[model samples]
Target: MKYGSTSAPIQLARGQAMSSVKPWRPDEPAATIHAEGAWLQGAFISKIFYGIIIVLSWQCLSLLWRQTTRSNYKTKMSFLAIVFAIFSFSTLHSGYDMKAIQLGFVENRNFPGGPSAYATLSRSDTPGNIACILMQWLCDALLIWRFVMIYRGCVAPMWLLAATPITVYLGSIVIGILFTIKKLTSGSGVRRT
Candidate 1:
């Protein structure tokens, strides 16, 4: 027989027969969790991780901004702008993800139905993804700019100034690439019934 085919029947003894089924227990919860709940729980954990990263990045930027009295006004303003952009993007992404999770988890059904469900359920179409991409690029640029400013203003060695930007860019690139890969490969997995 072919796989998944159920055409074959079992022979039973003359006295054997199926018994009536019992109702599910009231005290026992459903054995399987909904896909929406699972997705939202994952998103919540991710949001928390990203939130901590944002906080640490902001603190580092703040320290750099405070030490900017020794640098030029233009550089200071540029740094401030970069910091503001990062903060805005982080906040926006976090808020949007939270909303998406809330809608998916609380509603238990995609909004409106049909095509609308795709729009409601997918994070790729959300503003958060775009913001996240932009923020990642901005972070790389800011790191490079900070390194340049430090090198020019304080006569610091190129290697010393390169450290932060190199590390930040690598980290951002890794994160962006991983997220993209996850989005792409997730579709190939077996879907829940």
Candidate 2:
């Protein structure tokens, strides 16, 4: 099946069944239909994994909170902020995904090119995508901070050593911003502009 602006063949697995999926009209391209089906399936799997991560994260956050003390207030608070930011971003991402899923499957199931296509056209998932990107940037920044801390005294020229990662991180931010802009501007992936 073809999806978006791309036309490529896709086939169901040998034993796979389409009983759960309603048939698309004959006028719609098979590729677009199949792509939507695939996205729906992937969304289901993503939710399952997201649930597991949320559980583990909450447990870790609780443990951290319990272990925090007055002496380590600064460090602990910083960590807490980072963790909370991550949690918030991820929650936003997941919530948006669920919202889109509901709209696609329940509210707009009959939308042209299917729910997946509708998602692309409407750009309804942009917030989720932004959250995901922000979460990634936060994680990367944390890693870089940890790296600098670890190599602080040992490195003869700390600034030089840190320069590469900082540059790369900045580059990534610019790229991400450009990508978001592109996504926001593009009309729809289902139809070529």
Candidate 3:
């Protein structure tokens, strides 16, 4: 089966049952119909399921913040912001994926003088993937922070150790964001950086 830019192949998940069905043809509908209706249905259902989980997690964190009085306000606020930022970025990324499918696969592919249905990968279509990348960078930094706190116990040289990784990580983040914006605006879906 094929979706948006029927030229590309749809990579089914592992354990997916393969049908002898041919890929979408130019003469056929822009949106390819697949035999795996159940899987397609489940995909949408999972999106909703995860969305609910995010809301629940947000509520629990908010409640915890309100109930805890022993924690330093700055520390608590900093952690809370990181958590919020990760979730917000992930949600934004999902939204971008949805929009890519709608515009590239469903609508544009069906119309003449329009974009390919599957012309671009969702992540590279625009700067939207930066949300996901930033989330990843933040999570990695948090892990590094935790390690530094445990092993070094906030010793003076600990700052030196943390500084190197932190600096490198931030530099990479800047490069990633710039690369995404450049490729997106240049109308290229692939990134060399």
lDDT for each candidate structure: 0.63, 0.80, 0.63
TM-score of model 2 vs. true structure? 0.74
Backbone-clash count (model 3): 5
lDDT of 3 by residue, 1-193 (tens): 3357533433443223354554334554434444223434654775795597599658857975986566577777777788888778778777765665456545555544333424443333354577768867887888887878776855568777788778888887888878777656654343212
Ranking by TM-score: 2, 3, 1
**Per-residue lDDT of 29-145 in model 2, one digit per residue for the tens?**
778768877888898898897887688778878988998999998888888888888888888999998887888768877777677667777667788989989988998899999
TM-score of 1: 0.49
Candidate number that wins on TM-score, 2 or 3: 2
lDDT of 2: 0.80
Better of 1 and 2 by lDDT: 2
lDDT of 3 at 171: 88
Clashes of 2: 4
Per model, state how many residue pairs clash: 0, 4, 5
* Residue pairs that clash (backbone atoms under 3 angstroms), model 1: none
Those runs of model 1 whose alpha carbons end farther than 4 Å from true positions after fitting are 1-38, 108-125, 143-193
The candidate 1 region of ten consecutive residues with least summed lDDT is 24-33
Measured by lDDT, the strongest candidate is: 2
